[model samples]
Target: MSSSETRPDQPVITGATRLYAIVGDPIAQAKSPAVYNALLAAAGRNAVLVPWLLSTADFDAGLRGLLRAGNVDGLVFTYPHKQAALPFADVVHSRARQVGATNALRRRLDGRWEADMFDGVGLVRALEDVGTSPGGRTIWLVGAGGAGGAIAFALAEAGASQIHLTDVEADKATGIAVSVAKAFPGVIVSLAPPSLETVSILINATPVGLSDADGLPVALDDALPASLTVVDIVPREATRLLDLARASGCRTVGGAAMVAGQAAAVLDYFGETAA
Candidate 1:
Protein backbone atom coordinates (compact mmCIF):
# COMPACT_ATOMS: atom_id res chain seq x y z
CA MET A 1 0.00 0.00 0.00
CA SER A 2 1.14 3.51 -0.75
CA SER A 3 0.60 5.59 2.39
CA SER A 4 -0.04 8.56 0.17
CA GLU A 5 -3.43 7.15 -0.97
CA THR A 6 -5.00 6.44 2.45
CA ARG A 7 -8.13 8.29 3.51
CA PRO A 8 -11.04 7.71 5.93
CA ASP A 9 -13.59 7.19 3.19
CA GLN A 10 -15.16 3.75 3.19
CA PRO A 11 -14.49 1.56 0.19
CA VAL A 12 -16.83 -0.87 -1.56
CA ILE A 13 -17.44 -3.97 0.53
CA THR A 14 -18.40 -7.15 -1.27
CA GLY A 15 -18.92 -10.86 -0.56
CA ALA A 16 -15.51 -11.70 -1.96
CA THR A 17 -13.68 -9.11 0.16
CA ARG A 18 -11.24 -9.97 2.89
CA LEU A 19 -11.55 -8.24 6.28
CA TYR A 20 -9.26 -6.60 8.81
CA ALA A 21 -10.25 -5.09 12.15
CA ILE A 22 -8.49 -2.67 14.47
CA VAL A 23 -9.40 -3.73 17.99
CA GLY A 24 -9.22 -1.50 21.04
CA ASP A 25 -11.17 0.18 23.80
CA PRO A 26 -12.35 3.69 22.96
CA ILE A 27 -11.79 2.82 19.33
CA ALA A 28 -13.31 6.02 17.97
CA GLN A 29 -9.96 7.76 17.60
CA ALA A 30 -8.34 5.10 15.44
CA LYS A 31 -7.13 6.04 11.95
CA SER A 32 -6.33 2.54 10.78
CA PRO A 33 -9.59 2.24 8.83
CA ALA A 34 -8.94 5.47 6.99
CA VAL A 35 -5.29 4.59 6.51
CA TYR A 36 -5.82 1.02 5.38
CA ASN A 37 -9.04 1.27 3.37
CA ALA A 38 -7.65 3.82 0.97
CA LEU A 39 -4.50 1.82 0.54
CA LEU A 40 -6.52 -1.33 -0.16
CA ALA A 41 -8.48 0.52 -2.79
CA ALA A 42 -5.33 1.97 -4.29
CA ALA A 43 -3.63 -1.39 -4.36
CA GLY A 44 -6.74 -2.97 -5.91
CA ARG A 45 -7.07 -5.40 -3.03
CA ASN A 46 -10.42 -6.80 -1.84
CA ALA A 47 -9.83 -5.97 1.81
CA VAL A 48 -11.07 -3.56 4.44
CA LEU A 49 -9.80 -2.63 7.89
CA VAL A 50 -12.51 -1.66 10.39
CA PRO A 51 -12.45 -0.64 14.02
CA TRP A 52 -13.72 -2.96 16.79
CA LEU A 53 -14.48 -1.30 20.11
CA LEU A 54 -13.76 -4.04 22.58
CA SER A 55 -13.67 -3.33 26.28
CA THR A 56 -10.93 -4.81 28.41
CA ALA A 57 -13.19 -7.56 29.60
CA ASP A 58 -14.55 -8.52 26.18
CA PHE A 59 -11.29 -8.40 24.25
CA ASP A 60 -10.59 -12.10 24.42
CA ALA A 61 -14.06 -13.14 23.32
CA GLY A 62 -14.30 -10.41 20.71
CA LEU A 63 -10.95 -11.36 19.21
CA ARG A 64 -11.86 -15.02 19.17
CA GLY A 65 -15.06 -14.26 17.31
CA LEU A 66 -13.19 -12.18 14.73
CA LEU A 67 -10.58 -14.85 14.26
CA ARG A 68 -13.30 -17.45 13.73
CA ALA A 69 -14.42 -15.65 10.65
CA GLY A 70 -12.88 -17.12 7.52
CA ASN A 71 -12.72 -13.85 5.58
CA VAL A 72 -11.08 -11.75 8.32
CA ASP A 73 -7.54 -11.46 7.02
CA GLY A 74 -5.70 -9.68 9.85
CA LEU A 75 -5.99 -7.36 12.83
CA VAL A 76 -4.50 -4.01 13.80
CA PHE A 77 -4.37 -3.52 17.54
CA THR A 78 -4.18 -0.22 19.40
CA TYR A 79 -3.56 1.15 22.89
CA PRO A 80 -4.28 -1.54 25.53
CA HIS A 81 -4.59 -4.35 23.01
CA LYS A 82 -0.99 -4.21 21.76
CA GLN A 83 0.43 -6.27 24.59
CA ALA A 84 -2.75 -8.23 25.07
CA ALA A 85 -2.72 -9.46 21.47
CA LEU A 86 0.63 -11.22 21.83
CA PRO A 87 -0.47 -14.57 23.24
CA PHE A 88 -3.02 -14.96 20.45
CA ALA A 89 -0.26 -15.14 17.85
CA ASP A 90 1.54 -18.38 17.02
CA VAL A 91 4.56 -16.53 15.63
CA VAL A 92 6.08 -13.39 17.07
CA HIS A 93 8.29 -11.18 14.95
CA SER A 94 11.62 -9.97 16.30
CA ARG A 95 10.42 -6.41 16.89
CA ALA A 96 7.38 -7.64 18.79
CA ARG A 97 9.59 -10.01 20.75
CA GLN A 98 11.92 -7.17 21.69
CA VAL A 99 9.14 -4.72 22.56
CA GLY A 100 6.86 -7.27 24.25
CA ALA A 101 3.96 -5.87 22.28
CA THR A 102 2.11 -6.65 19.06
CA ASN A 103 0.31 -3.86 17.24
CA ALA A 104 -0.36 -5.79 14.07
CA LEU A 105 -1.15 -9.47 13.57
CA ARG A 106 -1.60 -11.40 10.36
CA ARG A 107 -3.18 -14.79 9.71
CA ARG A 108 -0.79 -17.13 7.99
CA LEU A 109 -1.98 -19.49 5.26
CA ASP A 110 -1.20 -22.33 7.64
CA GLY A 111 -4.00 -21.16 9.98
CA ARG A 112 -1.75 -19.47 12.55
CA TRP A 113 -1.64 -15.84 13.54
CA GLU A 114 1.72 -14.02 13.44
CA ALA A 115 2.34 -10.83 15.37
CA ASP A 116 4.67 -7.84 15.07
CA MET A 117 4.99 -4.32 16.41
CA PHE A 118 5.36 -1.21 14.25
CA ASP A 119 4.27 1.69 16.47
CA GLY A 120 7.75 2.73 17.49
CA VAL A 121 9.11 2.35 13.98
CA GLY A 122 6.21 4.43 12.67
CA LEU A 123 6.80 7.19 15.24
CA VAL A 124 10.51 7.20 14.49
CA ARG A 125 9.79 7.42 10.78
CA ALA A 126 7.29 10.21 11.39
CA LEU A 127 9.78 12.19 13.47
CA GLU A 128 12.50 11.72 10.90
CA ASP A 129 10.16 12.88 8.15
CA VAL A 130 9.82 16.19 9.97
CA GLY A 131 13.62 16.43 10.38
CA THR A 132 13.37 15.72 14.12
CA SER A 133 15.36 12.53 14.33
CA PRO A 134 15.43 11.07 17.84
CA GLY A 135 19.16 10.35 17.70
CA GLY A 136 21.12 12.21 20.40
CA ARG A 137 17.99 14.15 21.42
CA THR A 138 16.63 14.04 24.95
CA ILE A 139 12.92 13.07 24.93
CA TRP A 140 10.05 13.21 27.39
CA LEU A 141 7.42 10.58 26.51
CA VAL A 142 3.98 10.41 28.09
CA GLY A 143 2.28 7.01 28.52
CA ALA A 144 4.35 3.89 29.29
CA GLY A 145 1.56 1.78 27.81
CA GLY A 146 1.86 -0.39 24.71
CA ALA A 147 2.58 2.30 22.12
CA GLY A 148 4.70 4.37 24.49
CA GLY A 149 6.86 1.44 25.57
CA ALA A 150 7.52 0.44 21.96
CA ILE A 151 8.39 4.04 21.10
CA ALA A 152 10.74 4.23 24.09
CA PHE A 153 12.73 1.24 22.88
CA ALA A 154 12.72 2.47 19.31
CA LEU A 155 14.02 5.87 20.39
CA ALA A 156 16.84 4.23 22.30
CA GLU A 157 17.52 2.04 19.28
CA ALA A 158 17.51 5.16 17.09
CA GLY A 159 20.31 6.50 19.33
CA ALA A 160 18.37 8.92 21.51
CA SER A 161 20.68 10.33 24.18
CA GLN A 162 18.15 10.11 27.04
CA ILE A 163 14.47 9.28 27.60
CA HIS A 164 12.23 10.51 30.43
CA LEU A 165 8.96 8.60 30.78
CA THR A 166 5.68 9.25 32.62
CA ASP A 167 2.49 7.18 32.80
CA VAL A 168 -0.75 7.01 34.79
CA GLU A 169 0.55 3.79 36.27
CA ALA A 170 3.81 4.65 37.98
CA ASP A 171 4.91 1.04 38.12
CA LYS A 172 4.28 0.60 34.41
CA ALA A 173 6.36 3.67 33.59
CA THR A 174 9.13 2.49 35.90
CA GLY A 175 9.02 -0.95 34.32
CA ILE A 176 9.30 0.50 30.82
CA ALA A 177 12.18 2.72 31.92
CA VAL A 178 14.05 -0.22 33.40
CA SER A 179 13.42 -2.34 30.32
CA VAL A 180 14.66 0.34 27.94
CA ALA A 181 17.65 1.10 30.17
CA LYS A 182 18.57 -2.57 30.29
CA ALA A 183 18.28 -3.06 26.54
CA PHE A 184 20.11 0.10 25.56
CA PRO A 185 22.67 0.52 28.30
CA GLY A 186 24.10 3.59 26.62
CA VAL A 187 20.84 5.56 26.71
CA ILE A 188 19.70 7.09 29.97
CA VAL A 189 16.10 6.42 31.07
CA SER A 190 14.37 8.22 33.92
CA LEU A 191 10.94 8.11 35.55
CA ALA A 192 10.33 11.83 35.52
CA PRO A 193 7.37 14.19 35.26
CA PRO A 194 6.82 16.27 32.16
CA SER A 195 9.48 18.97 32.08
CA LEU A 196 10.91 20.73 29.09
CA GLU A 197 14.01 21.96 30.85
CA THR A 198 16.50 19.43 29.45
CA VAL A 199 14.20 17.83 26.89
CA SER A 200 14.28 18.69 23.20
CA ILE A 201 11.27 16.52 22.30
CA LEU A 202 7.96 15.91 24.08
CA ILE A 203 5.70 13.06 22.88
CA ASN A 204 2.16 12.18 23.89
CA ALA A 205 1.76 8.51 23.09
CA THR A 206 -1.42 8.01 25.06
CA PRO A 207 -5.06 8.51 24.08
CA VAL A 208 -5.47 11.27 26.63
CA GLY A 209 -6.22 14.15 24.33
CA LEU A 210 -8.82 12.49 22.10
CA SER A 211 -11.77 14.31 23.64
CA ASP A 212 -12.03 17.89 24.84
CA ALA A 213 -12.89 16.61 28.31
CA ASP A 214 -9.53 14.82 28.43
CA GLY A 215 -7.81 18.23 28.11
CA LEU A 216 -4.04 18.46 27.64
CA PRO A 217 -2.20 15.30 28.65
CA VAL A 218 0.67 17.26 30.12
CA ALA A 219 0.83 20.84 31.26
CA LEU A 220 3.23 23.07 29.40
CA ASP A 221 4.49 26.56 29.93
CA ASP A 222 2.43 29.47 28.62
CA ALA A 223 4.89 29.81 25.76
CA LEU A 224 6.85 26.79 24.64
CA PRO A 225 10.33 27.26 23.18
CA ALA A 226 10.58 26.95 19.44
CA SER A 227 13.44 24.51 19.80
CA LEU A 228 11.17 21.78 21.12
CA THR A 229 9.69 19.22 18.73
CA VAL A 230 6.27 18.18 20.05
CA VAL A 231 4.46 15.08 18.82
CA ASP A 232 1.00 13.86 19.77
CA ILE A 233 0.01 10.38 18.56
CA VAL A 234 -3.72 10.90 19.02
CA PRO A 235 -4.55 10.23 15.31
CA ARG A 236 -6.39 13.52 15.15
CA GLU A 237 -5.34 16.18 12.69
CA ALA A 238 -5.13 18.65 15.58
CA THR A 239 -4.99 17.97 19.30
CA ARG A 240 -4.86 20.63 21.97
CA LEU A 241 -1.17 19.86 22.57
CA LEU A 242 -0.29 20.10 18.90
CA ASP A 243 -2.20 23.38 18.65
CA LEU A 244 -0.32 24.71 21.66
CA ALA A 245 2.98 23.65 20.17
CA ARG A 246 2.11 25.29 16.88
CA ALA A 247 1.02 28.46 18.64
CA SER A 248 4.34 28.62 20.42
CA GLY A 249 6.27 28.27 17.15
CA CYS A 250 7.45 24.78 18.06
CA ARG A 251 7.74 22.13 15.39
CA THR A 252 4.70 19.85 15.60
CA VAL A 253 3.82 16.54 13.99
CA GLY A 254 0.28 15.27 14.52
CA GLY A 255 -0.88 11.64 14.80
CA ALA A 256 -1.88 11.40 11.14
CA ALA A 257 1.73 11.18 10.04
CA MET A 258 2.41 8.39 12.49
CA VAL A 259 -0.64 6.48 11.20
CA ALA A 260 0.55 7.02 7.65
CA GLY A 261 4.00 5.78 8.53
CA GLN A 262 2.62 2.63 10.10
CA ALA A 263 0.14 2.15 7.27
CA ALA A 264 3.06 1.69 4.89
CA ALA A 265 4.74 -0.96 7.02
CA VAL A 266 1.68 -2.78 8.38
CA LEU A 267 -0.07 -2.99 5.01
CA ASP A 268 3.05 -4.58 3.61
CA TYR A 269 2.98 -6.98 6.55
CA PHE A 270 -0.64 -7.87 5.72
CA GLY A 271 0.42 -8.56 2.13
CA GLU A 272 -2.05 -5.93 0.96
CA THR A 273 0.39 -3.41 -0.45
CA ALA A 274 0.90 -3.39 -4.20
CA ALA A 275 4.25 -4.57 -5.49
Candidate 2:
Protein backbone atom coordinates (compact mmCIF):
# COMPACT_ATOMS: atom_id res chain seq x y z
CA MET A 1 0.00 0.00 0.00
CA SER A 2 2.70 2.47 1.15
CA SER A 3 6.41 1.97 1.76
CA SER A 4 9.34 3.64 3.50
CA GLU A 5 12.98 2.79 2.79
CA THR A 6 15.97 3.21 5.09
CA ARG A 7 19.20 4.70 3.77
CA PRO A 8 22.10 6.52 5.29
CA ASP A 9 21.38 10.12 6.02
CA GLN A 10 24.13 10.63 3.49
CA PRO A 11 25.34 8.18 0.85
CA VAL A 12 28.65 6.50 1.75
CA ILE A 13 30.64 3.55 0.39
CA THR A 14 31.08 0.75 2.88
CA GLY A 15 31.65 -3.02 2.90
CA ALA A 16 30.07 -3.63 6.30
CA THR A 17 26.48 -2.54 5.72
CA ARG A 18 24.42 -5.46 4.51
CA LEU A 19 21.03 -5.40 6.25
CA TYR A 20 18.45 -7.63 7.90
CA ALA A 21 15.70 -6.80 10.37
CA ILE A 22 12.83 -8.12 12.50
CA VAL A 23 9.49 -6.37 12.17
CA GLY A 24 6.84 -5.95 14.87
CA ASP A 25 4.65 -3.42 16.66
CA PRO A 26 6.86 -3.35 19.75
CA ILE A 27 10.38 -4.26 18.78
CA ALA A 28 12.10 -3.23 22.00
CA GLN A 29 12.00 -6.68 23.63
CA ALA A 30 12.97 -8.74 20.60
CA LYS A 31 16.14 -10.84 21.01
CA SER A 32 16.41 -11.39 17.25
CA PRO A 33 18.80 -8.50 16.75
CA ALA A 34 21.27 -9.84 19.30
CA VAL A 35 21.02 -13.41 18.04
CA TYR A 36 21.12 -12.63 14.34
CA ASN A 37 24.01 -10.23 14.67
CA ALA A 38 26.03 -12.96 16.33
CA LEU A 39 25.02 -15.51 13.70
CA LEU A 40 25.89 -13.19 10.85
CA ALA A 41 29.30 -12.47 12.32
CA ALA A 42 29.87 -16.17 12.85
CA ALA A 43 29.08 -16.77 9.20
CA GLY A 44 31.48 -13.98 8.21
CA ARG A 45 28.66 -12.06 6.57
CA ASN A 46 28.58 -8.29 6.56
CA ALA A 47 25.04 -8.11 7.82
CA VAL A 48 23.06 -7.47 10.99
CA LEU A 49 19.47 -7.80 12.08
CA VAL A 50 17.85 -4.72 13.60
CA PRO A 51 14.45 -3.95 15.09
CA TRP A 52 11.74 -2.23 13.08
CA LEU A 53 8.61 -0.79 14.63
CA LEU A 54 5.57 -0.11 12.51
CA SER A 55 1.89 0.24 13.17
CA THR A 56 -0.61 -2.40 12.04
CA ALA A 57 -1.94 -0.18 9.28
CA ASP A 58 1.62 0.42 8.04
CA PHE A 59 2.96 -3.13 8.05
CA ASP A 60 2.46 -3.57 4.34
CA ALA A 61 4.05 -0.26 3.53
CA GLY A 62 6.96 -0.79 5.87
CA LEU A 63 7.61 -4.28 4.45
CA ARG A 64 7.51 -3.09 0.88
CA GLY A 65 10.19 -0.55 1.59
CA LEU A 66 12.38 -3.07 3.35
CA LEU A 67 12.19 -5.54 0.46
CA ARG A 68 12.94 -2.86 -2.09
CA ALA A 69 16.13 -1.89 -0.35
CA GLY A 70 19.23 -3.32 -2.01
CA ASN A 71 20.97 -4.13 1.26
CA VAL A 72 18.24 -6.00 3.13
CA ASP A 73 18.05 -9.67 2.15
CA GLY A 74 15.10 -10.61 4.35
CA LEU A 75 13.11 -9.78 7.45
CA VAL A 76 11.72 -11.86 10.30
CA PHE A 77 8.10 -11.20 11.09
CA THR A 78 6.81 -11.10 14.68
CA TYR A 79 3.51 -11.00 16.51
CA PRO A 80 0.52 -9.08 15.10
CA HIS A 81 2.34 -8.78 11.77
CA LYS A 82 3.00 -12.41 10.82
CA GLN A 83 -0.53 -13.17 9.64
CA ALA A 84 -0.79 -9.84 7.83
CA ALA A 85 2.33 -10.34 5.66
CA LEU A 86 0.96 -13.39 3.85
CA PRO A 87 -0.75 -11.67 0.89
CA PHE A 88 2.34 -9.68 -0.08
CA ALA A 89 4.46 -12.73 -0.73
CA ASP A 90 4.88 -14.07 -4.26
CA VAL A 91 5.44 -17.54 -2.82
CA VAL A 92 4.02 -19.00 0.36
CA HIS A 93 5.71 -22.03 1.89
CA SER A 94 3.45 -24.96 2.84
CA ARG A 95 3.83 -24.42 6.58
CA ALA A 96 2.75 -20.79 6.31
CA ARG A 97 -0.17 -21.76 4.13
CA GLN A 98 -1.27 -24.44 6.56
CA VAL A 99 -0.86 -22.18 9.57
CA GLY A 100 -2.49 -19.17 7.91
CA ALA A 101 0.49 -17.04 8.92
CA THR A 102 4.00 -16.15 7.82
CA ASN A 103 6.82 -15.48 10.24
CA ALA A 104 9.59 -14.83 7.77
CA LEU A 105 9.82 -12.94 4.48
CA ARG A 106 12.65 -12.89 1.95
CA ARG A 107 13.31 -11.02 -1.24
CA ARG A 108 13.50 -13.15 -4.35
CA LEU A 109 15.86 -12.66 -7.28
CA ASP A 110 12.87 -11.32 -9.13
CA GLY A 111 12.38 -8.78 -6.30
CA ARG A 112 9.12 -10.23 -5.03
CA TRP A 113 8.57 -11.19 -1.42
CA GLU A 114 8.38 -14.87 -0.46
CA ALA A 115 7.32 -16.00 2.96
CA ASP A 116 7.20 -18.97 5.32
CA MET A 117 6.00 -19.94 8.78
CA PHE A 118 8.78 -21.53 10.87
CA ASP A 119 7.55 -21.60 14.47
CA GLY A 120 6.38 -25.21 14.46
CA VAL A 121 9.31 -26.52 12.49
CA GLY A 122 11.62 -24.63 14.81
CA LEU A 123 9.99 -26.15 17.89
CA VAL A 124 10.23 -29.68 16.55
CA ARG A 125 13.79 -29.10 15.43
CA ALA A 126 14.72 -27.67 18.82
CA LEU A 127 13.22 -30.69 20.55
CA GLU A 128 15.25 -32.98 18.36
CA ASP A 129 18.34 -30.96 19.17
CA VAL A 130 17.79 -31.84 22.82
CA GLY A 131 17.43 -35.56 22.02
CA THR A 132 13.66 -35.69 22.17
CA SER A 133 11.57 -36.82 19.26
CA PRO A 134 7.90 -36.07 18.96
CA GLY A 135 7.24 -39.31 17.09
CA GLY A 136 5.59 -42.02 19.17
CA ARG A 137 5.75 -39.64 22.13
CA THR A 138 2.77 -38.38 24.10
CA ILE A 139 2.99 -34.57 24.57
CA TRP A 140 0.94 -32.21 26.69
CA LEU A 141 0.92 -28.64 25.30
CA VAL A 142 -0.36 -25.59 27.09
CA GLY A 143 -1.79 -22.58 25.23
CA ALA A 144 -3.44 -22.86 21.82
CA GLY A 145 -2.71 -19.37 20.56
CA GLY A 146 -0.77 -18.85 17.36
CA ALA A 147 2.52 -20.30 18.59
CA GLY A 148 0.78 -23.09 20.45
CA GLY A 149 -1.42 -23.97 17.49
CA ALA A 150 1.63 -24.11 15.25
CA ILE A 151 3.50 -26.27 17.78
CA ALA A 152 0.55 -28.64 18.01
CA PHE A 153 0.44 -28.93 14.24
CA ALA A 154 4.19 -29.57 14.05
CA LEU A 155 4.01 -32.27 16.71
CA ALA A 156 1.17 -33.96 14.88
CA GLU A 157 3.15 -33.84 11.68
CA ALA A 158 6.17 -35.18 13.54
CA GLY A 159 4.19 -38.35 14.37
CA ALA A 160 3.19 -37.65 17.89
CA SER A 161 1.00 -40.47 19.17
CA GLN A 162 -1.14 -38.31 21.43
CA ILE A 163 -1.46 -34.59 22.15
CA HIS A 164 -3.45 -32.70 24.75
CA LEU A 165 -3.81 -28.92 24.29
CA THR A 166 -5.15 -26.37 26.74
CA ASP A 167 -5.79 -22.65 26.39
CA VAL A 168 -7.35 -20.04 28.59
CA GLU A 169 -9.97 -20.05 25.87
CA ALA A 170 -11.76 -23.39 25.71
CA ASP A 171 -13.00 -22.77 22.20
CA LYS A 172 -9.50 -22.10 20.91
CA ALA A 173 -8.13 -25.23 22.56
CA THR A 174 -11.05 -27.28 21.26
CA GLY A 175 -10.58 -25.90 17.78
CA ILE A 176 -6.88 -26.79 17.70
CA ALA A 177 -7.57 -30.22 19.22
CA VAL A 178 -10.15 -30.94 16.52
CA SER A 179 -7.76 -29.77 13.86
CA VAL A 180 -4.98 -31.96 15.24
CA ALA A 181 -7.25 -35.02 15.37
CA LYS A 182 -8.45 -34.36 11.84
CA ALA A 183 -4.98 -33.74 10.51
CA PHE A 184 -3.50 -36.80 12.13
CA PRO A 185 -6.26 -39.34 12.44
CA GLY A 186 -4.28 -41.79 14.54
CA VAL A 187 -3.17 -39.26 17.12
CA ILE A 188 -5.26 -38.97 20.27
CA VAL A 189 -6.39 -35.38 20.96
CA SER A 190 -8.06 -33.84 23.98
CA LEU A 191 -8.76 -30.54 25.71
CA ALA A 192 -7.90 -29.44 29.27
CA PRO A 193 -4.74 -28.64 31.26
CA PRO A 194 -2.21 -31.42 31.21
CA SER A 195 -2.26 -34.03 33.92
CA LEU A 196 1.11 -34.96 35.41
CA GLU A 197 1.19 -38.56 34.30
CA THR A 198 2.95 -40.49 31.60
CA VAL A 199 3.26 -37.69 29.06
CA SER A 200 6.74 -37.90 27.61
CA ILE A 201 6.93 -34.22 26.73
CA LEU A 202 5.44 -31.01 28.13
CA ILE A 203 5.39 -27.76 26.16
CA ASN A 204 4.29 -24.40 27.50
CA ALA A 205 3.43 -21.96 24.73
CA THR A 206 1.75 -19.38 26.91
CA PRO A 207 3.22 -16.01 27.99
CA VAL A 208 2.78 -16.72 31.68
CA GLY A 209 6.51 -16.67 32.43
CA LEU A 210 6.76 -13.33 30.68
CA SER A 211 5.61 -9.89 31.91
CA ASP A 212 5.59 -11.10 35.49
CA ALA A 213 2.40 -12.91 34.75
CA ASP A 214 1.45 -14.67 37.97
CA GLY A 215 0.91 -18.41 38.00
CA LEU A 216 2.56 -20.92 35.73
CA PRO A 217 0.55 -22.18 32.81
CA VAL A 218 0.75 -25.68 34.22
CA ALA A 219 -0.88 -26.23 37.58
CA LEU A 220 1.22 -25.86 40.76
CA ASP A 221 0.04 -29.16 42.20
CA ASP A 222 1.41 -30.81 39.13
CA ALA A 223 4.75 -32.52 39.68
CA LEU A 224 6.74 -32.84 36.50
CA PRO A 225 7.67 -36.44 35.87
CA ALA A 226 11.45 -36.88 35.74
CA SER A 227 11.09 -38.81 32.52
CA LEU A 228 9.26 -35.92 30.90
CA THR A 229 11.07 -33.50 28.62
CA VAL A 230 9.86 -29.96 29.31
CA VAL A 231 10.03 -26.91 27.08
CA ASP A 232 8.91 -23.37 27.70
CA ILE A 233 8.73 -20.91 24.79
CA VAL A 234 9.23 -17.76 26.79
CA PRO A 235 12.40 -16.03 25.50
CA ARG A 236 13.55 -14.47 28.75
CA GLU A 237 17.14 -15.12 29.85
CA ALA A 238 15.79 -17.16 32.74
CA THR A 239 12.37 -18.31 33.81
CA ARG A 240 11.12 -19.59 37.15
CA LEU A 241 8.99 -22.30 35.57
CA LEU A 242 11.95 -23.61 33.61
CA ASP A 243 14.06 -23.45 36.78
CA LEU A 244 11.46 -25.38 38.71
CA ALA A 245 11.30 -28.01 36.00
CA ARG A 246 15.07 -28.43 36.09
CA ALA A 247 15.27 -28.35 39.87
CA SER A 248 12.73 -31.17 39.95
CA GLY A 249 15.11 -33.39 37.92
CA CYS A 250 13.19 -33.12 34.67
CA ARG A 251 15.13 -32.58 31.43
CA THR A 252 14.32 -29.07 30.29
CA VAL A 253 14.61 -26.92 27.20
CA GLY A 254 14.62 -23.15 27.42
CA GLY A 255 12.96 -20.54 25.25
CA ALA A 256 16.27 -19.71 23.60
CA ALA A 257 16.21 -23.01 21.73
CA MET A 258 12.89 -22.15 20.13
CA VAL A 259 14.11 -18.65 19.32
CA ALA A 260 17.30 -19.96 17.72
CA GLY A 261 15.45 -22.64 15.80
CA GLN A 262 12.95 -20.14 14.48
CA ALA A 263 15.72 -17.74 13.55
CA ALA A 264 17.48 -20.51 11.67
CA ALA A 265 14.37 -21.13 9.64
CA VAL A 266 14.01 -17.43 8.99
CA LEU A 267 17.61 -17.30 7.84
CA ASP A 268 16.88 -20.24 5.57
CA TYR A 269 14.04 -18.28 4.05
CA PHE A 270 16.67 -15.70 3.18
CA GLY A 271 18.50 -18.42 1.27
CA GLU A 272 21.24 -18.73 3.86
CA THR A 273 21.63 -21.75 6.14
CA ALA A 274 22.98 -21.35 9.65
CA ALA A 275 26.68 -21.87 10.06
Query: Which candidate number maximizes TM-score?
Result: 1
Per-residue C-alpha lDDT of model 2 across residues 50-69, encoded as one tens digit per residue: 88998898877777777778
Per-model TM-score, in order, reads 0.92, 0.83
* Clash count, candidate 1: 1
Model 2 superposed RMSD (Cα): 6.3
Instruction: Give the whole-model CA lDDT for all candidates, comma-separated.
Output: 0.87, 0.78
Index of the highest-lDDT prediction: 1
> What TM-score does candidate 2 reach?
0.83
| C-alpha lDDT (0 to 100) for residue 2 of candidate 1 | 34
CA lDDT, candidate 1, residue 175: 85
Error of 2 at 154 (Å): 1.6
Worst 10 residues of 2 by lDDT: 1-10
